[model samples]
Target: MKDSAVAPTRVDGYAELRDYAVIGDGRSVALIACDGAVDWLSWPDLDSPTLFAAVLDQARGGRFDLRPKVPYTAARRYLPGTNVLETTFTTASGTVRVTDALTLSDTASLTPGRELVRRIEGLAGSVPMGWSVQPRFTYGAHAPHLTRRAGVPVATYGAEAVAICAWHAGQPQCTTDSVTARFRTEVGTRALIALPYAYQEPLVLPTHAECEARLDHTAAAWRQWSDERTYTGPWREAVLRSALALKLLVFAPSGAVAAAATCSLPEELGGERNWDYRFSWIRDSAFTLDAFLKLGCAPEATSYLWWLMHASQLTHPRLHVLYRLSGGTRAPERTLPLSGYRGSSPVRVGNAAAGQLQLDTYGELLQTAWLYTTAGHRLDADVARRLAEIADFICTTWRQLDAGIWEVRSAPEHFTQSKMMCWITLDRALDLAVRQLIPARHADRWHEERQAVADFVETRCFSERMNSYVRSAGSDDVDASLLLGLLHGYRPSDDRRMSGTVSAVEKTLRQGPYVNRYLGPDGLSGSEGAFLACSFWLAEALARCGRTEEAVSLMDQLVALGNDVGLYGEEIDPASGAFLGNLPQGLTHLALISAACAIGEAAR
Candidate 1:
């Protein structure tokens, strides 16, 4: 086995997970360090046990660090139309190029044989490069034993086997870790490193030319798919980046889209609101469908709805707010013992709030269902029945308190958002029933309940004291979600009440330019950064309300909050406007695409 050129040098923890850029195969993803470490990756699939978990804990989280032996600043980008990641490190000595990608299986087979190909090419002066491979299984708890087979280093952990090898043009033996390799690259020198999952006898290694060809094909595939996007707008690049991010989150084989790639990144860093977002959410799906449709990305919408079709068939008493990526219904929550990112304690894996009764989901589901059916797709009878049953359930349960949109753990109250969603459920159901001329068994009843709910929002949700819609009845605090009331077709955007609510939200919940969901104390202890999705919602609502100029400015600012590659998290710090929370968030991208399309169309 070859060793890294230099001993492992810690990065002093300066690189936060937020600073990392993402690259992924359609099946799984890897988070690469700005300095060139493949820090976080899962094997076999997105939800599989981690082969590199260093992001959660630098010491125990197995990391595959490949970079110059000397200090260097790196620049990275994804090759057009592909998940291939290329990082160029500029050092005092010279420049070295590293490319990373997961190889596609050429034949029909399944095993722990996922290959992570990394190629290093010398572009300038001679530079030394290093490699470290540590396999931490089960979220950094178990360490694997390393051995050499046929002169190639392979790490074995339980049922998984990861092979690693390096080839450099005319370079002799360097140093070695159990799996690490070291070498030097000068001008005109090229080296290739491959990590292949081996299931058969003597895993055959692809030649350098074969690797290059595969990389080219992958790039072509991505560009071709991206070219299908017909969005021509002011924020075209940002929208494109967001669309790409959404594509990355999709677990292609299963047609399941995760809400976000990683879990528990924290809404407020070090706060208790940290929860897993790697699972698929019903609401996320509905919203994502509408967003994708707007961008002319119909395949994602069709695929997701099909996934929802199967998911809805589960025999549970009610649908979960979210589900596992592989369509698994069981997501029992457990805490990992290791310290979390930046000491954010209680690192959790499975989501516990999946069973919560979020009344708002009905509105989203029905609204998107209506969208698909209106677009000439036939409604599944089972889907329609289940949907109507949910509407009826909301009709009966709307008056009762449940967890609101934020999934707050406090004993449920009559959250105005929940009530408004109840209104939506009835509104869309009645609309669909009317369009199809089908008997809405309780059309009049649903209409009456919907109006009653609307009236409830007017009377109880709005506060006379602030002259704006409050978070809920008897509370003076404003909620940003009220902005959706107008956008969701509950009221005309020009309605005075909505205008007043928007102004009130601006005055109270708006931190500088960004918006917070609520001004009231969330039961959690720490303060949170401004919610980016809420700010984007404000932009969309403003556009719908005919405040196009203000909406455009706000949208520009929100787009600027994205990282260099055009990804955003849940929140942004008002001070520096830096992104926070689990990054490449589904909600954030969905909002960007929808806002861009709405603004783009309105402008035209």
Candidate 2:
């Protein structure tokens, strides 16, 4: 809700991550900077090549700019319970309000496959406004061929097209790679702009009336979805906002929730720790399924589990660390030529962690299935067979080193979290067999191996001097991820070892509400900010341990950490309070939801 009259503060032409809010239409999302620029958007789908990525490269990445020509300070918020954002600008001349949304499709008209609608209204004296559309295709690698469809300006690249339909605004004049316009608004004036997009199909050049109706309908639809949410807990506002943010990351067509909206957002300024988080991770499975069921998103919960099984069939019984939104297995890491956000170079597109051997994934998947079945959802015969086989696979695979939950690039090691999750995998498998959800012929072997895994974790992972479980087999350092060992029932909250581990994590890895992933080397050259998800995990662990007052105090601070629009990024710089990674981060929101629910339950 802040920006100076001239502009939002920018360093090297990049707005602060916290100064951005996101809007989406299930299929795609747009990152609109506080100063009113749509800086990042991947068209047609969440994981597709960018149509606007100024967040990645200021000079080459395209954007849609809209703001008052005269200097104006701005304040913004989501329009009630909806994702639609309303921004108000106050200049000396007058005040103006703008509504922004990636409009949802409607059956009342020939709606677009994808559409971004912006509405502007003048409330006081005259205010001059300006807008421009700079269309760059294929991650800013291709300049679109600009033309006109009937009276509207159109940008085309191969089979993809975008037609700009505007009314009561200025005449759009096309330049080489952009279209610009200028206009003035008096009291009670209204204007609208719509970008109707097409992919491998004919463009839908929407009418002004249809665009206006669609915008209204989209807002109503969002409100309806929000009203249906069942979470009636403390911090309901933040929890619901996180749920909306999570919805944006869900690829609606496939039911796979993406890890984040944009890619290559740096974990540290001018650092090589930048990564692409567009794919869904196996580690988020348990929490995602849990949150969906808790929020009464039953359809999403079912599709998510079905999507998980369907996507991993290609690599059956062996889960990749992550999978593409469309259920694809491969994500070959590649870099773009453009300079990254704020000069963080090698802007990457794909995730290399997809190929890593993360033993924690097996436990996460099995836990998800267990949760699903416990919620009264049935696993079919085929999926039941695969779950049993995966448990069997873990029996032998748990002995190998793994990249672990954080996906560290360092040489694989026997991470303590990975070993604990291996134990969870077999324990859940034996439970499923006892429930007769899966075959019990191999239950005896699973039980024996589960004990072996438990023995290894208890004896080797616990540090006698530290009175806590170490990050790896023998190290004394504490890791924030160790908190999951308690959350997932690896150990009860009353267990002295678990309590000591929580204490060690707080002592070694926390400063106030901020929590570092680990203090040790991650095999990367540059350091990263505190992981936001870990901080939320600590809040949940505290609540589970019956430290309700402390949990509430910590959560109060953490909830305030969200930016004005109640959105969180992947990480935060504790020293500066600057968001440090890809925005609308799924894991951070998932952790927030999980923490809020746990704390609410404990307080009750």
Q: What is the C-alpha RMSD of each candidate to the true structure, in Å?
A: 4.2, 1.3
Scanning candidate 1 in windows of ten residues, the lowest lDDT window is 1-10
The positional error of residue 150 in candidate 2, measured at the CA in angstroms, is 0.9
Model 2 lDDT per residue over 1-604, tens place:
2223434678888999998999998889999988899999899899999999999998999999998898888888998789999888888899888999999878977778899999999999999999999999999999989998797899999989999888998999999999989998889999998999999988989888998898999899999999999999999999999999999898999999999998999999999998999999999999999999999999999999999999988898899999999999889999999899999978999999998999999999999999999999898999999999999999889999999999999999999999999999999999999999988788999999999999999999999899999999888878898999999989999999999999999999999999999997889988999999999999999999999999999999999999888999999999899999998999999999999999999999
Worst 10 residues of 2 by lDDT: 1-10
Local distance difference test scores for all models: 0.74, 0.92
Per-residue lDDT of model 1, residues 1-604, tens digit only: 0112322234445255546677777787778766788888877677666777776677777788788888887777777545577778888899898888776554433423467778888999999888777777778888776677776666766667777766772222323324665788999788887777643344555556666566555667778878998788878878887888888889888788888777666666566666778888877765688877777877888888878767766833366788788887888888887666666667788887887888777677777787777766767676777667766777777787778788777677778877887798898889878876334787888888998898888998887668787777767778887776766777777778878887887888776568988866656678778888888888887788777898899998788777644668888888866566776688988888888877776676
The per-residue C-alpha lDDT of model 1 at residue 414 equals 78
At residue 260, candidate 2 shows an lDDT of: 94
Give the per-residue Cα lDDT of candidate 1 at 520: 61
